[model samples]
Target: MAERHLEIEQKYDAAADFVLPELDGLPGVASAGEPEVHELHASYFDTADLRLAAHGITLRRRRGGTDAGWHLKMPAGTDSKQEMRAPLGRPLVVPARLAGLVAAYTRGAELRPVATLETRRTVVRLLAADGAELAEVADDLVTGCGPDAEPERWREIEVELKGGTPELLKAAGKRLRKVGAKKGKSSSKLGRLLGEAVVPAQAAAARAAARSRIAAATSNGKGPGITTGEVVLAYLAEQVEAIATYDPKARLEEEDAVHKMRVAVRRTRSALRSYRPVLDAERTVPLGPELRWLAAVLGEVRDLEVLRMRFAEAPAFVVEDLEKREKAAYRRMNASLREPRYFKLLDELDRLILDPPLAGAADRKARKELPLLVTRAWDRMAKDYASIKSADDPDVARHETRKAAKRARYAAELAVPVLGVAAKRVVKDAKRIQEVLGGYQDGVIAMEHLGTAAKRTKVPAEAFALGVLYGKEQCEALAARDHLSTTWSQTLGPSF
Candidate 1:
């Protein structure tokens, strides 16, 4: 089993000759507990190229402390990390589960012991008036060993919060400074031993600069060696990042996180479909179904959230029914997030961004290639719009039209940064079509939910209210249908 916590702490470099200062008189410290000492031994692991360390991530197996275990630390904030812990296993071996969790960064790279630190730590606990422990301070003497380096030694002070506020940390820093202790030179023992920052700022800045140039090339429609493939892949890469960025937020049930992740998945899938000329469709086709699988699972929870908020005025019994379904939907969402298939999907996406499969057309200038792609998507939407206008089952046709509109909108969006105002105009019109159709689809879903609620509760007042809501939705759908022709005509002319 494993557990996670936020490790919030500060560190300061201490001279070998410095004496320990009295911390009891600080802000919330009423008295201090007896000083306890421990000899801690930790071995750090990383890829041969130091991939994990370069990203400010650490994997270690440590012993001889109250928190001894296998720990993985990922950068969370300026001075914070999300630490995941697992029980100690056989010596010098990392736990399989812990290794699997970081596969996103390590990929298939080997995790070998890179460095070892042996620390003789003296710890003091600061207390509050109520005897509640606020924080713990550790003064340490360390010996570091690397692959082929001679043993090195250092001394430092670490102030880690147990139940303390930021104010307590600030107060402690003041006292430590007065006694000759200064801020720690490095964030981690491993970082200090390696003599490098956890994240290499210069390397990160250079990568960011390169990405900016690629973005500029597409946006300005000018850059030597810029190709149609570069623009599409850059947009796709951004969406891939969005999916990963929102993954944890959605798992933690943050507001609208799931919706944003789902949108990223849809946008990526649409980009792949719309830019088939620039990319080899055969290789990219498999990705579409995987993206759709994720989106459908996310939609189950998102749709419920929308309904619960939309019908907040519904009768108590109806609201209760909705709540039950919402809980089940959330369970489904959480289960899907934990599945191995989802992780595989993420890995595949990362691989796609790293090395995309491109065809001959990809090397051509985006200025000439992208507009033609946009026109194809628009023409598909036009056909779907005409079909909806003439179909007997207008509801079914409207759904298809909605999907087509979305594709056209995404296509225009990809072009807007390059094609300028003309593409922006298409984006606006395409969006209106999508929203109008979205409302109709929502109404369809709402009626089904209302019918289910009416059956479950069998309450006459609730049933009557459901009928009224259904009628309103019917009217809205009809109104949207009436506006479709004008909306389509506004921008789908030969010029666009």
Candidate 2:
């Protein structure tokens, strides 16, 4: 079994002769305990290409520590990581459970020992006025060696919070820095060992700078003079990063993780479709179906999640059945994440960002080429809306319009950096159209599920309760239908 923890800590660089600072007078501190010494050794693992390290994840097996174990640390938030630990077992092999969490990044690549570190540490514990252990400061003298590199020695300080608040941590950092401690450059010991091999390239930073430049130009009423490929690739990279960031969270069943991952997938797929004039069809078209396939798998779990919330007040049996189905759907979704097909899809996305196959139009200025693409998306939604007004069965037409609105909304969002307020208005209007029709679609689906549940139940009371819920859902669906005309009229402000 693996135990999970939120690891919150800060690290600093220190000279070999740098002395520990006085900690008793810091905020919320009464006294600092005498130093305790320990010898620690850790072996770090990653894919041959260092994929995990590139994403700020660490997998290690450590010995001679109070919490010695096989640990998988993933970025949770600023200055914090979600760490999962299993008992230290095999000396060389990565634990199956921990490996499964990073399958999205590894994509079935073999994990191998990349670096090793041995640290001699002295720890001083900071205590509160009431004697609670608030935090621990470790002064570590580390000797690190990578796969083909010579051993390198360095000294650093680590302050890990136990029961302390962020303010206390900030105070401790202030005091440490006051005594000549410089903030650590690398995020981890392994990062310092592997050096530039694991650190992301400067190209990523350049892309971000380019995005800011384009947005600034557009905001100043000057056209973005950058190529369409630059704008589209930056947007695609962001969505792909989101997909990767949320993959492990979704696997761990974190709140809203599956929905977030699915939305990223949809955005990527939508961009590929809406920007086809600028992107090469030969390489991008096949990716659309693959992204859709992944989204459908995630949607299965996301839909059940929504229903579990919607029917929270329903009969116990009804909730229980939904919970059971939800668990099963989640298991299936998890299995799909580990499939070779899913891994290949992720690899393809990586390639698309790294070596984009751009068409002739991609060489044109973004401000000139992107607005037409966004307008085309808006036209698609308008056509679907017109079909809904004339169709006898509005359910199917509404669903089509809803999907078109989502695509248009995403398209406009992608162009906002290059089109300014004009694109933002389109985004705002398309979002309203999507939300109204989305509610109608949800009501329709809920009623169908309730009717199916009513038929499957053996007890009359449960069946009667389900029937009542179905009636309510039908009423809501009808109300949404009535609101569609009003929503459409109000949102008709933006045509692009």
- Identify the leading candidate in terms of lDDT: 2
Superposed on all Cα atoms, the candidates' RMSDs to the truth, in angstroms, are 5.8, 2.2
Model 1 CA deviation exceeding 4 Å by range:
1-55, 58-73, 76-210, 216-225, 316-324, 338-340, 468-483, 489-496
lDDT of 1 by residue, 9-128 (tens): 899999899898888987788999999999999999998878778767889999998999999987778778878888988767788767765665565677999999999999999999
| TM-score of model number 1 | 0.72
TM-scores of the models, in the given order? 0.72, 0.94
Pairs with steric clashes in candidate 2 = none
Q: Tens digit of lDDT per residue, candidate 2, span 92-133?
A: 999888998999888999999999999999999999889999
Q: Rate the local accuracy (lDDT) of all candidates.
A: 0.81, 0.88
Clashes of each: 1, 0
